[model samples]
Target: MSDTAPKQRPQYRNISVPQILSYRLPLAAKASILHRVSGALLFLCLPLVILPLFALSVSSPESFASLRSYVDNPFCKLIVLALIWGYMHHFCAGIRYLCLDLQMGNDKHSAKKSATAVFAVSLVLTAIFGLKLFGVW
Candidate 1:
């Protein structure tokens, strides 16, 4: 037997911390995150924004007229436009998710395409309605 013991093998480990923010996320991941964000925004706005506006608009003829005029403000128009974007994005993304759950477009390339399509459809819809909202048409 040799005086020296057998040499021990060195152990290697993966210790690098990933830079999540700097990393480029896939389109599907980005859309999924935005979907949740838009949903939360709409949910939050429901109690604080839409209900009050609806109540005020239908409370009486005087209130209805005041509410209608209130919406004529540029600030109100912008707020409504934002809400429209939230709604359109949420709806389109929800459909995308439903299809994914059914196992359609579950592949990597298909998922990316679907995500791009979802974003395009949502933005196009928002643009169209936004034009109408701003009285461009």
Candidate 2:
């Protein structure tokens, strides 16, 4: 038998809070986390922001005009833009997850590609809607 010793495997350890900030997550993991965040944002805003605005807008002509003006402010526009991004990202990621459930793109390479595609498509869609919202024509 040879005298050489077998190589030891690297030890795996739990990441600490400080290390977490600097730790690099894989693209698919990042996308999955963001998907959860966006879903939460949508769920919370539906009750807090969207429902209130819809109720006010449909209440009366004056309320509708006020709502329109409120939405026209640059600050409000930015918030709307954020909501647009959240909605788009959540929708794209949801579809990706559905495909995953169906066993599509189940491999590592395809998973990464789909994650990248989700980001790209969501951002592109958000940009298009943002341009319209800002009256960019």
lDDT of 2 by residue, 11-54 (tens): 65977788778879989999999999999999999999988988
* Consecutive 10-residue window with the lowest summed lDDT within model 1: 12-21
Candidate of highest TM-score: 2
> Candidate 1: where is the Cα deviation over 4 Å?
1-18
Question: Model 2: runs farther than 4 Å from truth?
Answer: 1-14
TM-score of each: 0.82, 0.88
Positional deviation of 93 in candidate 1, in angstroms?
Answer: 0.5
Clash count per candidate: 0, 0
Task: Give lDDT: candidate 2, residue 89.
Answer: 100
lDDT of 1 by residue, 36-104 (tens): 999999999999999999999889999999998899898999999999999999999999999999999
lDDT of each: 0.92, 0.96
